[model samples]
Target chain A: MSHVTDEVKGYIGVETDVGRCWDVVERGAVRRFAQAIMDLDPAFMSEEYAAQTPYGKPVAPPLFPLMQNRLPYDGTDVISERADDPDYDGTGGAGPSSNLPPLPLGNLALLNGGSEVELFRYLHHGEGLSFRHRYADIYERETSKGLMVFVITETDYLDDDGGLVARVKRTTIRR
Target chain B: MRDNDAARADAPADPRHFEDVSLGERLGDLQKGPFTTPHLMRWSAAIENWHKIHYDRDFTQQHDKLPDLLVNGSLKQNFLLQIVKDWATPHGWPWKVSFQFRAMDVVGSTLFVWGAVKRKIPLRDFGLVELELGIRNQEDRQSTPGKATVALPYREGGPVPYPFVPPSADELAAGEARAEGA
Candidate 1:
């Protein structure tokens, strides 16, 4: 593995739009998501049960926005492009969640380290939601395997009124 | 908490009264999976990604040197959220939740997402409760461990403000002052 250089460290504080997509939180999507997580919260599915709650409407699961932002079609998709290369080791690819710049590391295995998230509100049915994403930071640490790099990206999900829904800081690891 | 038992057992929560909560109250365990290849693929499909490592055993083993088709970290996070989300339910708002995968959870492993009340801070209008949470595999090895904070309205204080609002710095200081005084 190459040393984590100054060029790589420069990516810190670098930000990208990662685009804004508008969506109406639908009941069907919420149902599927709740099922996928095995969380059968009525507030996410049963209209009669949800209307009795403070929200007065069915809402998406807490992390639903992560699913809403699908694979972006930038004409040359990093994930798809890398898939065509037979040598790809099934790592170091980006998904809809972050816009962190690709690191200088070549052909290293990657893992979704984990995340820290803050939720101020839920995305409810029929409400318009927008997501703002940016690469918050990048850093490296020495490991027994060698040197490893960690990428931190922050995303803010907002309602149409621009009120905050959730703020997420995701960590991706490369070794 | 096995995956099948917990899913079959969980019922809807009633609005929890702030007065009823106490330190060390167990937010009942949540179990998920015997997660198989199909379960992993469904999650990948749910998120609309076709990451070959999740589905292609040849690619994962021959190229990546992994033990098996790895369970999605994203999926594990969802299970972690499920525990607190349902625990808070109609009464309390799951204000903030976070966790990390301390070890890899491979395919065919069942996960038990568990949490317990850590601390409770009484606010003027509501109560903020903190808890330590984690997911453990069938073998009782813990993988993801983290903590969360939730806002629960007082039984008499009315529903948590619709579109929840986080305590500001000044409010937090005042709450701390109140907490110390109590």
Candidate 2:
């Protein structure tokens, strides 16, 4: 396996520049998302049905961008360190600093823990999307097994018209 | 009545009305064989997902250090949609669906897709039903969790149901919480 360090720096504390456009949503793209996710609702495909909605175009399914690669986030709010023991659940009574586990050799190990996404609107078909993200939170906790890193990344999706479509905060557990 | 036999057999019956459904009713479960390279490939082709990790095991091994082919994130989401829409076919569209990717759904694992109605809300013209939904592997590992809201008939006789309005995040979270409790 490639050392975790190589991919760690690329993913951890990484941010996309302002106005960097990601062709995150389009008509074909939305249709594909709808098809991929097995959502057969005609509203996602029928121009007339979607036109009745607020967006006035066939809208992409709510979670489409997440399926795309090259996610962007703001990295200003990250904290990294080696852990003494990495198996601690983040539910410790104290605040982030005290409850954090040790970091290991500045070596990064990360995996998808889970996330919460809030959608305000759908990405209308054929619309260009630009987004930027930020490191919402980062900390470490110790456990009998080893130390692990708890990282939260937040990505904001915007349309070419500059309206917010959705926001997602993904938490990754790195050991 | 004797003359109506041919007409009755030829004409398809109307979809079941939403009024016929009850809370906690199941749509029946769908099971797929253990995941495999071909299954993943078909799903990927259908969705046009080109993520290296999903198809290229070598890349996954070298870059992400993950085991065999990682399932497409969207595929799991698709499975949830399939389970819900199939159950709701009688009612028509349920407007909103939002879910989170919980864990990597790997190959060689059987998945059971299922859902149950939690409650029904009456609207001025139509009714909105909230659903608690999930997809799990054979080992009972939940791969995805989310909520769907469907529009139903206010009374026994109503206009053909239309696509439902998808629920907002708050609504989905509340529904998810309820499902967790169950």
Candidate 3:
């Protein structure tokens, strides 16, 4: 029961146009994110300290780019829309790498397999961010639990000038 | 404004130069938890990740057929980067990190993120330190296992260039050649 049908395999090399986030890096969002992770580094908040650092300004945490693809203000409410659906996993709407067409796996459970990230610089506050992602690879493996499909996606996070901020390769497992 | 004291405590007063680090040296563990649903919820909300398994215990147990409200691999990853970043920042830069979610850490688990210097490669300008890292629970069950590379300045040199310029292929080859010769 190979899930790697020709259609699924066709998604390999599928890439999205560079899309900008709805908002620039905001101080408040960075604060909440830093607090949530319990990483209270002053470089992420204290303007005074950041000025002395090499970055010269307060910056978001290294992995902040991954969360930059937020829903627009006028975006549809998938949570409300799927409130009545029992199987809705609460993950909906276009996200960082969701611009690609959905894989043909029907009713399979999704899990985050892991990721490899190469960080060039931190996202500075007030800086606009853009991303382009591609389906780098897709394959299946037989595990003790069952057969699972692994989807590898590579996303490049860039600053307003299109300078690279971080490059992330994420693996999503479908069972 | 948001507890600057903790931030200052995490910040290294002095720069960590390449010469300061030794192979096989261990970094101080970064601990978080006994993580509860609130922790997972905050992380999910912060990132706007609506994965039900992180918050909806009923769905996680009944539908997903999991043991408990599983912690977000996303959140755990921050812990991984934090340990490396906190260790390398102020003077050095965390260049690359890779990890696999080999196991799961459910709610109520306390996670300790740990890292150790595995190898050090010295280029012409700066050096790269390779580290083996992971997260383990109170029960000593390892969940996330990964490796990282951090760029550090030599003690006699300036800071590791910001917007880190990775060593060119030639520089890497020359550094490896030097290491092999030594």
> Quick one: best TM-score, which candidate?
3
**What lDDT would each prediction earn against the true structure?**
0.76, 0.56, 0.88
User: Mind giving the per-residue lDDT tens digits that candidate 3 earns over B1-182?
Assistant: 11122736533468888888888999878889888899899989998889899989899888888898889998889889998988888788999999999998999999988999998888998988899999999999999999999998898887788898888989988887776675
Residue lDDT tens for model 1, B1-182: 44423343223456777788888999888778888999998887776666677889998888878788989898899887877876786678888878776688888998888899988788888988888999889999999998998888898887787678888888878887776787
Which parts of model 3 have CA positions greater than 4 angstroms off?
A: B1-12
> What stretches of model 2 exceed 4 Å from their correct place?
A1-20, A31-35, A38-41, A48-57, A68-109, A141-146, B1-34, B38-53, B58-67, B81-104, B119-130, B139-141, B145-182
Best by DockQ: 3
Highest lDDT scorer: 3
Give me the overall lDDT of model 1: 0.76
Q: Compose the digit string of candidate 3's lDDT tens values, residues A129-165.
A: 9999999999999999889999999999999888999
* lDDT for model 2: 0.56
Q: Give lDDT: candidate 1, residue B23.
A: 84
Candidate 2: lDDT of B49?
39
TM-score of chain A for each candidate?
A: 0.82, 0.62, 0.96
Q: How far is each candidate from the true structure, as Cα RMSD in Å? A: 2.8, 11.2, 2.2
lDDT of 1 at A129: 72
